[model samples]
Target: MIYWSANSTNSNQQSLSGSNPKKKVHSGNANNELEWRDLEDYPLNLSQQEVMIEEGKAGSSWGKSEINSGYNSLLSRTLQVKGSKVNCFFDTEAPKILVVDDHAASRMTAAALLAMEGYEVIEADSGAAAVVLVTQKHPDLILLDVMMPGMDGFEVCHLLKQDEHTRLIPVIFITALNDRRSRIRGIEVGADDFLTKPFDRVELAARVKSLVRQKRLNEDLDHAEQVLFSIARAIESRDPNTGDHCERLVTLGQNFGEYLNLSRSQLRDLMWGGYLHDIGKVGIPDAVLLKNEQLTLEDWEMMQQHVLIGEKICQPLRSMRGVIPIIRHHHERWNGSGYPDGLKSNEIPFLAQVFQLIDIYDALTSERPYKRAFSPAEALSVMWEETQAGWRNPELMQRFTDFIHTYNLK
Candidate 1:
């Protein structure tokens, strides 16, 4: 979300300006009060009052002092993530806060405080409207109103908590109701926190900050769990005759995935995809998977079911739908002759291609009951020959080689 702002000096002693044009200024102070130049006379895109009102939602009082303090804190935090002297500006990567209230004055004030505190703020007038905005915007936090017609705050919170899609989002009730029953009801309906209607700006800011921090921590933990499960079934069930096959494949797949310059989301998928690439092996009869002799034609056919088996095993992870493509297609050949589906070239998912290379490499290099491990050189020679024979994507092969060299793979 890119936001353009007129040049301005903030109360926190931070200024954002270029030699190009007119400037507007905003600042936060020791008491967290915010002061911004009244640009009513200036060609401001939005009113100064508007900015203040938005920032107020985050608990900054929007007074010159509190605004100044909040801005100072925000600047320091931004600089820590980016760097100092890079020209003070708003942090674009910051999470958004949605201020939900039927009252325009309250909504505006809260929003202003949040903005001054360096959070992007969105406003919704009713509970129904808030629900729409929540689904569309996916705000980092929701500051909900307790009283609204048609769909009240409690109902909205209940709806949000019930949906598997939005249930994890933290919601804080912001209302004038100070009754004990109201507070209990809010918690019962899954409110993470609450703020009274007439809130102390400083306290509000602190609570928002704390909630945002916890949200980040939760996201990290979720990622860790996904990664662990993705590979656990593959690693734990296999015998020593395969000799840590899943472990070796995981390392190679991860390295190759990084080489592909995959995003964190993609990396997560691949991590699990690599770890569970052989999950289908679980369904293979022990007679076939552990056979010391060469695989009979019928036995080889049964081995192919592992991909389907793996896909079925991981079906519960529909949230990780992206992973299914890679898992099912990892054995697909570039020439469209491999696996459960004969997808070729770009038709094959990228992660699957990555795993294909690593899988073959691991198979060649690892000792099996039927044969001793091949030398790295011998393995590479075989891979190269297969590439020349149109068994794998030549371009992907080159990428695999670069990945190997960059990661110093054996």
Candidate 2:
């Protein structure tokens, strides 16, 4: 249960729950002696009779459904009291919104509105404060003000969007500036929505709800991708000889792609391919997968089907489109002697070719069940021989050799 004191001046008072609240007030509002109690005191055992009263108004109740909705919101967010200093422990499961405005009245109004809707609202007085809060709080949505002293809304939004960690958090510019140029600027800086000042409460709620829903869906997709990666790692764990193989390939493949000036999309594909290229091996029987002796022709044929199986496994994810080629063609040879498709030189995907070199280089330099680890020079020599025999792209092979030598890569 949450307790609120309306205009009571007792600074040392305890909450109704019998806990002495911490008296650490926010620096901006030193006159307001609001104490924040321990968040663990927040009860999951909510009662129907519980009522949340307005700060200064008495004899008004928001109904049991609203109370229940607020409780549900508390499950995933830190409970913040309106018109007071907020310094509470975070409950990460809640949907949180950050309201940023230099004006105290406007900021409090927005916070109160969002908080009333059963969404956790955090406040920032300025653009700098907003950026700091975003990094620390990781709010699901941001209602940013356009005009500010330093680091305005556009700058803050641009900074947040540029970062990989914070980019997905939706931002809506709430400002008095409703001109076309400002809207275009907001779009360029990655603001998801715009709300003009004296904005309608209904419109604000609708836009916030839509963007938050979209953000959650994107998060779900990210979770699904992580699950696929976990499965790939699990499959790799089954082969003792391939320990850390995927990790090495991902690092090396990314570095080589960067050296080759590959686009961000291609680089992303190379990284995914490193983990998922051999994911089809999950479909192979353990007996064949762990075999120590040379495989019979039929066993070899079955082992070769892993690439196709892996491609099919990952085909459902639209985001994996760029990566699919790398997964399917990494084993193909320049001389058209490869399995599955048997595609000749230039027919193989370029990203796959880049990944194959990293894979082969790692294989040669790392110890295997059958062979000892070779020196970097020795590995490059072996790669050179393969390139000469038409098993690899000669131009790319020469570039790889030069890159290895220049970087002194092991």
lDDT of each: 0.67, 0.74
Model 2 clash pairs are 76-93, 76-94
Return the top candidate by lDDT.
2
| Model 2 ranges off by over 4 Å | 1-94, 112-118, 127-138, 149-159, 162-164, 178-189
Where is model 2 poorest over a 10-residue stretch in terms of lDDT? 24-33
lDDT tens per residue, model 2, 1-410: 23434333222222344232342222112122222333333332222233233344342121123422423211112334443211222224447898888765566556545554546677776787777778777889999988888778999999999998899999999766547888899999999999986656567767887798789878878887898899999999999897899999999888888889999999999999999999999999999999999999989999999999999989998889999998889899999999779999999988888899999999999999999999989999999999889999999999998888876745
- TM-score for candidate 2, please give it: 0.73
lDDT of 1 at 214: 76
What is the Å distance of residue 91 in model 1 from its true position?
40
Q: Find the candidate with the highest TM-score and give its number.
A: 2
lDDT of 1 at 154: 97
